[model samples]
Target: MVENLTEEILEMLGNESRRRILNLLSKKPCYVSEISYSLKMAPKVVLDHLDKLEKLGIVSSYEEGRRRYYSINRNLRVEISITPHRFIASTVSETPELEIDEFIKNMENLLKTPAGSLREIYKALQEFEEVERQFSEILGAVSLKFNEMFERFLTEIEKEVEDELERLVLLGITKGADTPFKISEEYGISYMGVIKALKSLENRNIVEKLENEDVWRIKC
Candidate 1:
């Protein structure tokens, strides 16, 4: 099994040249000189990008005498998780262990089944559709839980801080608007209002101000 290379893929694909190289390889495999001439980029740059792709297992290479060919396996799936509080990029496995043989068997009846049995065929189609509906329901339930957790976190913060400004400021921190200016801009509160709230929380040891930067965080 290949190791997880999500991070490497993200980093490697960030380069314009690497993206171009992958675009070229998607059409067909090529050697070093072939890529250089096709992309009009230097041979060294092509080699460097290919080297990184090889290490990440995103590109495979094989030698034909002195010439080496590079090709992309296209064995990748990207999954992005987005919520109000966080965003995550993950690489899902290229291959899934889905046991759909039973579903296929059920569909196989349509082969010999007469076209006059349209209603029967429709019923069989509904069975496959139910699978999609079940998956959608599960995903919807999981997404609701993310919001629920955030609301629960806010409930605890509300218990800790009675002032509305302080509560908003703390919530803003968790949302990554740690600086006073950012919090003010994000929540549409006045800049001075954010500063006053920060000072109040700081004096009460509810928040701490970091030196060198105008950043603040909820006191642990």
Candidate 2:
């Protein structure tokens, strides 16, 4: 498993386009057209990279109408370690014991089998109900864990930025100021000072300026 994970990570990093896609997604969730425009790549090419990233669980997407917005999978962390003997790459995240996709495929195949008696069908239904209950419990646990991890992550980020001005600037952006000008006016800071703080935030990947727009947005 370690070998397989290492190979997967290597393959992901080997492509320049994939790396660029990750960089952009890290800053903000974006639709395919947005990513393609920002990277100056073809839409088809951007989608190909997104597909590979999604398969590896490094990226995830959600649909809004006809557009799908892609973002990094914050639940999983990838780590690489090198020792004298070998290099290892691994993912640290919660994984279900029963693979849902495999379960669904098996159920579909089972449907082709000969019909069983009513008693057998009843027993199967009971078993399926038990499995469903267990899955629900597992999903609840995963959701709680993810929320805890996210809160802890936010706490760490808060501690990392100790500057009062920067924090205020971040708060302003979080409050929905799209540009530094609004933040500056609200905080009574000079425009240049706001820009400086914004630049720092951008460097830390805490905020991103949308392409073709003068507005900035908080990444979190």
Candidate 3:
């Protein structure tokens, strides 16, 4: 069962667009237009990616009046393992003991409370501010972990590719040089060299050009 699920998860994650969609949905629930705008993808393309994610059970959606909102399935936690013979993928509950339903109910009750005395309103505001602060701290921790993982992944790639030019191009892209021309100009490398490195990176799926655009971006 774990092997089968791993294969399915790998197949679903093979597409860059789907992975991007999942990343966006993980942060917040969003409508198709919002996702399209954020990812610089066409609405139709965004919808297609969302469809695939929903089918894979990684994302779920609901219709709100005329718009549909999509969100990640936060309950599902994916784990990957690699060995000499095979790779394994598995899923587990992210927070099996956390009563998210009860927390939501409490939050809803707080939101529905009517404004009362000035002191009462001030206390409520203080509590909400504290909650916001806690959320910020949690988000900061997640961001830090993500950065560490990205750096480690880059280090592994650096080991596989020994060419200095390719490494420069990758570093440039990581630092926000989206186009080969920009990378060349910023790094003082020849235009042809930047282009050559970019092609190699694309072939290795390290970076990709956005559809209908001249810009290339690192596929993180």
Top-lDDT structure, candidate number: 1
- What is the C-alpha lDDT profile of model 3 across 1-220, one tens digit per residue? 2666667777888989888888888788999999999999999999888887888777888889998899987466566544322234676655554587788668857655446988777877787788868876885576567667768867876896788999888877766778878899989999999989889988988889999987888776
**For model 3, which pairs clash?**
none
Q: What is the C-alpha RMSD of each candidate to the true structure, in Å?
A: 10.9, 19.7, 17.1
Tens-place lDDT per residue, model 1, 90-141, is 7865665556656555555644344668896786567657765786688768
Candidate 2, residues 1-220: lDDT per residue as tens digits? Answer: 2667657877889999999999999999999999999999999999999999999878999998898999998565565544332244676565745687688668746543336888767777777777667866885576567666756655765897877788778767754666888989977888998999889988989889999987998776
| Regions of model 1 farther than 4 Å from truth | 1-4, 100-220
Alpha-carbon lDDT, every model = 0.81, 0.78, 0.79
Clashing pairs in 1: none
Estimate the TM-score of every prediction: 0.48, 0.38, 0.44
Candidate with more favorable, higher lDDT: 2 or 3: 3
- Kindly give the stretch of ten consecutive residues in candidate 1 with the minimal lDDT sum: 105-114
Which is the winner by TM-score between candidate 2 and candidate 3? Answer: 3
Which candidate would rank higher by lDDT, 1 or 2?
Answer: 1
Candidate 1 accuracy as lDDT:
0.81
